[model samples]
Target: MKIATYNVNGVNGRLPVLLRWLDESAPDVVCLQELKAPQDKFPEEAIRNAGYNAIWHGQKSWNGVAILARGTDTEIKEVRRELPGDETDEHSRYLEAVVNGVLIGCLYLPNGNPAPGPKFDYKLSWFERLITHAAKLYTLDIPVVLTGDYNVMPTEQDVYKPERWLDDALFRPETRAAFQKLVAQGWTDALRKLYPDETIYTFWDYFRNAYGRNAGLRIDHFLLNPKLVGRLTTAGVDRHVRGWEKTSDHAPVWIQLKEK
Candidate 1:
């Protein structure tokens, strides 16, 4: 089955581009981030018409996450809406579901810009929570896929110019270390595993002709638990999608798995 993740930026404003991608890519399972809409504002009917059954956690004009399963035969069930370890945290950034027997975790990690501030502190705190929760998921011994816009460049290879972004929140030493801690829990970075030497990027900023210059960052990622790693067949980014008119800065990233 083909599984994909995309940060739509704003589900409403980019509805057309999203619909077109859904039709063209036809992934069996899709994890969406940055809906930038309230729960009630989600375009359920439009998504339904596009042949997907979805469950979403939305926030007002900010972070949001969703999981979509294509077709009727897929058994989709919501398992969790928020990450454990934080009751006070109300960000609609994490959502989990079981899609055709595989556990899928879709998340939109905090941007945490302007480091050494409260927002950066919150980003680290959130990372800690995710790391703790991910450990629990690791022990489940089931096929699991944790995919989304991670918002961090895990390594220098993930960024267009490592030196330029060294102090940026997304490429900071603390941020990268946190990501490594999560992956050290025995989750495989699918894209990196498949193409270790290649410079792959999933997001490109709108300014400075970033997309045109191919100046991008591989912040969006797919992590597979031990049980799911063996099933990984292929992975890639739909880079062209980022160039579409009124499209998101992020392109779609995907992985295909062998049938059970």
Candidate 2:
């Protein structure tokens, strides 16, 4: 089965481009982030007409996530409205489902810029909860895939201008350490493991015409559980999608796996 993760930026604004990509790519499963639309505003009928069954957790104009599975209604195992210990109900960052018996999670991690502040603290706290949840998932002994715009460049090589991001939240030592802890818990960073030496990327900044310059970052990813590692056959960025008119800053990252 082929699974793809895309940060659509905004569902309404990018509907045309998204529909076109869906038709062309034909991925069996898709996890979308940054819908930027309210729950009532989601175009459920349109997505269903396109042969996808979707379950979305939406909020107004900022953060949202959804899972779309071709020809079948997704079995949403959980809708994490609140990260543990987070009383503010701040962001709609995570949603998880079971598709074809594989536990999948889609997340839109906070872009906690201006570090050494409340936002950065929230990012770290959120990561801590993710670690706790992931540890429990590991105990379940089921195939799992976590995919999304992680908002963190796991390594210097994953970004085009590494030095530029050295001081940014995405590349900070603490952030990387948090991400590394998750990987150490037996989740495989699929793209990195598959093409270790390749400088492939999935997101580009709109300013500076980053896409035109091929300046991008591989912040979007699919982290698979150990059980699914050997089944990973193809992993890549659909960079062409970034060139579409009115496209999202991030491109789709996809993986093809051997049948379960």
True-vs-predicted CA distance for residue 52, candidate 2, Å: 0.1
How does residue 225 of candidate 2 score in lDDT? Answer: 88
lDDT of each: 0.93, 0.87
TM-score of each prediction: 0.98, 0.96
- Model 1, 1-260: lDDT tens per residue? 99999999999999999999999999999999999999999998999999998899999877999898998445679999999888999999999999988999998999998997888998999999999999999999789989999999998888887899987999989999999999999999999999999999999999999999999999999999999999999999999999999999999999999988
Error of 1 at 75 (Å): 3.0
Clashing residue pairs, backbone N/CA/C < 3 A, model 2: none
TM-score of candidate 2 on Cα atoms, chains taken together: 0.96
For model 1, the local distance difference test gives 0.93
Worst 10 residues of 1 by lDDT: 67-76
